[model samples]
Target chain A: MNWHEAPDMRNWILLLLLLLEIATFTFLSGVRFDSAGDFTAYFQSYLGDLITQSTPTLLLAFGMTLVLITAGIDLSVGSMVALVGCIMASFPGNTEFWWTAVPLGLLTGLTLGFLNGALVAWLDVPPIITTLGTMIFYRGLCFVVMGDLEKAPFITVPGYEWLGIFSGVIVMLGLLYLIGGPYVYHSRWLRELFMMGGNRIAARYAGIPVQRRTLQVYTLIGFLGFLAALSFTARNSSISAGSLQGFELQVIVAVVLGGTRVQGGSGTLLGAFLGVMLIAVLEEGLRGASIWGDTYLPFEISHLEYIFLGALLLIGVWVSNIAHQRSRA
Target chain B: MIHGRLDYRHRRRIYFLLAGNLLLLGLIRVLLKEGSSFAEVLRRAGPDVAPVILAGLAMTSVIFVGAIDLSVASIIAVAGSAFGVLVHHDQPPWICYFACLAAAWVLSMWNGYLIRTLKIPAIIVTLAGLPFYRGLALIVADLGIPDFGGNISVYDAAYHQPGKFYAGWILLATIIAALIWEAFGRTPRQWLARGNSEEACRLLGMKPERILQSAFCAAGIFLGFAALIAVTRLQAIEPGRMLVGFELHIVGAVVLGGTNIFGGEGSFGGTILGAFFLYFISQALTYAGASAYFQEAITGAVILAVIGLDCAIHRRQKQLDELA
Candidate 1:
């Protein structure tokens, strides 16, 4: 029950879930090969598609895991993505110009994130209500800025396609794993996030500077949202107010499925990374099977993905609860 | 010094609540003067505002227990969609209505069970239920039930009467509920207990879980009835759009009516006034030639402003309490 005690059972469950996900993907993909000629092609393309679609979610969930570990939720991430994507797409395409556009978009996102942080940290607003208000406000701004128009040309820029495609996802995941993993595991300032989430008043009394840390956490989430926006825009080659609709929910779902407690205190970014992959694989695999598919249902699978995700989240929570109960007992 | 301080504190609290109500009434008057016929306006506003008032009432109950129901809108959607499908299948209207209500009640009970027994946070439980209910609604919609006719007006005698007179009925019900609650609903005692500390409530042998469960169940029933009124009035259900963001509106109303979002202190009367204030503003904006988009922005602003005001009042009260 102590903070440093490893949640062995939850970790094992996470591994099992990941394995089950891979198996499901394999089975759903039909595992076809005609004399091995098409085997690598089908396999690579399927894996590539899964990685590509999941990149943004993975990045968002990565940051979300940390935020949730601090016992705070960011409902504004999706709106931040839309706002940042719109800003990036509004710029005329030129590889040389992306340096400016991307940074500017990130700054805008960071500023919005800081606003969220300030509200919660300084103004004493609850995270849920503060983020809820910002969610509406930011999305409204997006609509106002974009005029509700869906811009397609910016996404199709030369060299930009890689951002939405598999290569970009892999690169982003790699960089995060390199940077975020160590910062979380090794640093004192960073580790306090879990302690703060575990018990804010105690952490505050312990000189953990709860308010400042909370602000930093939300601001970082906003920055990650900017990165996700870049990836998403590059992939779809389109930007609209509706671009990342319902995305925040997906990120939260992924985080929870990864076994992060909503009440905060403990979680691993690695679990979130794997969680995104699991969801992506499930969707892609279900699609490849063509059992029942529709435009709304990943275009290649049935609407069952939603139900499946919900069930997974519930089961994950239940299992963790049981583990916690038993550990306490 | 103590006597004077107590007198000042009591007067200040009364003044604050009165000022909030007066500001809302002023907004209503401004809305009433805008374009529509006075009589037609009342008729239209009645049905349109009824669900919000009812839902706000329901939300108030949950807020009293310091919990929120994000899934209420989805419940409305599911119930509306289910009713649409059943009625389409030539099922008796009464049967279809009851079934929808029953389903919503059961789902809410499930939420209560999860929060109480499983000890899940109310926000997380309701957040999950929000999507689950939406998915259920969508699935039911896609099951090949015929769409309710566009602009189909329900003229069923029984349904028409409720739609026509429900506003007054809601008002009466709200007054009765508030009186009953104030007199015997354990408000003063629970507030005293929760305000002291949750630990103190347990030490005093209060069954917090039972209280919360009952509150959620009651909210579920209220929401079901609100959904029924909305669908019956439309005479055709569009689950896709029926109560989208309706929960936010209810929350806004509750908060504006002076209910503490953090819980324990609120009034049903204030909530009724809050609902009327919102309905009036929307009606006014339309009459003033504002677009629906502007109306939404205004509503959002109103919600923020009300919450902001509540925060100020709460801070002042805390200061006074400390001073005492």
Candidate 2:
């Protein structure tokens, strides 16, 4: 669980892959730079926008890393965020959002997370099954709350737009990943999570509070879900029952790509960060190069994203496994 | 039933599902309008339940060998895309059906191959395949059709025969075949053995990997029929959007039917009943005049409640075994 435990080989490889993607897509997108400064400016603004747009995913990836470390997954995350956003949207876009809607949304997320934890930890329902069930149930609740309505009241909320901006998000990520991440990385708390994930029964028999740890990890994800919902709603300035569909998989993929084992017992927040960026870059690159794809490819360029993302996940996991085996040898 | 192969839990699940189905039917009958016959319920049951039951059966076989496929819905989309492309080309209906079946079979076999070759878990392989196959479907449709939009429309009645007309017959035949296979086949027993313990299976001279692969092959065949039925029933083949959330429903049905999620024990009869029970639960919601939005919530709650209760009931036994 050391920050330097896995070394930096995978990160360097991912960084190179990200650079290659940007280079290819930039050429494909026909970005014409008048000067060196112009190119730098263009890239700066592009990166800024990409980070701003993908803040929710990045935040969730932090939480997902911890969950994976515990050998549990919260597939209900997307639905949880959507439901929270929908709940927030039900209120007016005034200062009341601060005192009423936002806190309520956070509580809803905590309650939902606690319920998921109870099912998995207390009732002994498998994490996957519990989350799958909750994924549907939470989504169903979203539909009931919003009922085919798309709410956009966040635009009127004072200072809410800050959450969507580069500077604001940078501060948040700096705190979460830099300050909070390192704290958790070095803590006995996280080591205990690793222990539980590596072997739950062994940890339990050793007097680790297994049930409490499971509950805490899930509840922490819930708090992260609240932050994610805030970031998502502020940026999109809208809410709907179906918003953020397929988002859980995106977060899971990014974390997994970061070399987080699905079997758990180990993960790094830094890896999750890099994984999120790699995917965010690909997403933006595909969008920018859509015209190129239209000309050179038979399918819609958007469809290629799915293909690339899927291929990237498989390749990432396969290569990681190979590296893992080689290191073992 | 079916000799001693069917266990106590399997029988209990079958009974539970059957009772639920009948209870829903009775409620619907009692609440029916004067003119509407219970016959309407029977008539609509086959096509409605066919795909889910088939998918459940497919999943049951895989889960029997301690693996799962989260890629079934995506695979269905691929099969549907193939069917749509063939129909667009004015291929014979039978040819289109055969091609659809082949697409499912090949992809499922490919799933087996990937899991075997990579030594990665089936869940991870299929999780990747989920989006990969959907993208493959979209790419296939985009490449095959001229002036392709988001969806390919197939309005020909001839092409809809399997999904619309013959779904019942197909369901009956497949159910019968699967039940018989579960009862007496060496393959099913082998799957159970592998699921129960891979090392023990190897010690007994059986190859666990090969047995697992054969289960996938059997699942592929069942999924082929499921895909055929699912695709033909749709008037428009929207590969990207078609059959979204189908894998969950199939998983739900299989688990409800008393199949262990961790594998090693189950019954095809239970799966058939599980699918019917789910279908009837939703149908009852419609009849009870519940809001459409509430239906999904109710379905999710029902699934959670059923599974949660079952797990809760067995918690003490599991704890005791751990202590032992």
Task: Encode model 1's per-residue lDDT on A1-329: one tens digit a residue.
Answer: 44224665556657787778777667655575676768778767867887778888988898899889988888778888998887777777776546877789999889988988987776666676677667766776676567758887664466777777777778887788777677667889667999988988778778998889988888988888888887888777788875676778888888887878988997877778767777777776666667424433432234456557766777667767777776667
Best by TM-score: 2
Itemize residue pairs with steric clashes in candidate 1: A155-A237, A287-A300
Q: What is the lDDT of residue A320 in candidate 2?
A: 82
Worst 10 residues of 2 chain B by lDDT: B1-10
What candidate 1 gets wrong by more than 4 Å, as runs, is: A1-5, A28-31, A34-40, A88-101, A289-301, B1-35, B38-43, B141-184, B187-199, B233-249, B273-291, B294-298, B305-324
How displaced is residue B301 in candidate 1, in Å? Answer: 4.4
In model 2, the Cα lDDT at residue B315 comes to: 98
State which candidate has the highest DockQ: 2
Output candidate 1 Cα RMSD.
4.9
Report the lDDT tens digits of candidate 2 across residue range A159-277.
99998788888988888988999899899999999999899899999899999999998988888888889988988999999998888889999999898999988778888988999
